[model samples]
Target: MDQLETMTCSRCGGSGHFSYNQIHGTRCYGCNGTGKKYTKRGAAAAKFLSDLRSIPAEQFKVGDLILYQGISHSKFVRITSVEVSRAKDQGCYSGDGEYQQVKIQCEGGYGAYYRPGNLVRKGCGAEMKSEQLRQALAFQATLTKNGTPRKRAT
Candidate 1:
């Protein structure tokens, strides 16, 4: 899991400035009038890290907490199976349905997992390295080299 590089300020908890001199009704310039510096990793970055860990189905199991990509929040889900079901239209923005579909139960809330390719589709400002796909394919080689599990968390 990736740790937040910076934390919210303790004094004002990242309000970015503080209102001081109450009698004069003035703000504090020392703290930038909002009292806290923005964290290096803000809410969006935090959410992105959380989403990375919540990539869903690390290991297929029953009643595991499942998460679908392109959805809002850490929506918990109960899983039934993790095996590939059939080749279905993934509705990918890349217009490529090359990947196989792994069917899952909704278990109440939204249960749609967006294809990773959609990250490029939305112009999300993230680019995968050319070697990333190759490394993913050669997982055993990566594990041998790193000798550490590539753990992701939400």
Candidate 2:
């Protein structure tokens, strides 16, 4: 296998082959029996998927450093308390995203009731590579294999 393009199968120890072979073993589940290796894209997708599922700093526990928006860049603040309550989205797109209110109090004698879905963790945005898996998933659902966006019904 070409290292620059694809990886060698590790699951079957590169023994599995696309064609019949007497000495080598059959392909394993890692690469669908064709090869036991994961493509570069597959590895990248795994990384992005993990980033997508992981909680924001494990739900921002007390004493956790947070970078709040509506504040200066990277001006970290410590979390003092966290609570949840019923609240509407406080933005122009008031009807979108999570509606449950998340109240966070900082140790600096200040508090902010950030709008749900407005609190974006670092590397968690449309333009971020950390969201590449999500972008791929969304695109697969909304686009065709030939690189054309699918059309919706009228």
**TM per prediction:** 0.35, 0.34
Tens digit per residue, CA lDDT, model 2, 52-126: 544443266677656665644444577889777766555744556437766878776756665456533432334
lDDT, model 1, position 73? 50
Best by TM-score: 1
- List model 1 lDDT by residue over 38-147, tens digit each: 24333334344444434334334556655444534554466655555445554753446566554555566445543332221110122542233233334433232223
CA RMSD of all predictions: 13.9, 16.6
CA shift of 25, model 2, Å: 66
Clashes of each: 9, 0
lDDT on C-alpha atoms for all candidate structures: 0.43, 0.55
Q: For candidate 2, what is the TM-score? A: 0.34
Worst 10 residues of 2 by lDDT: 117-126
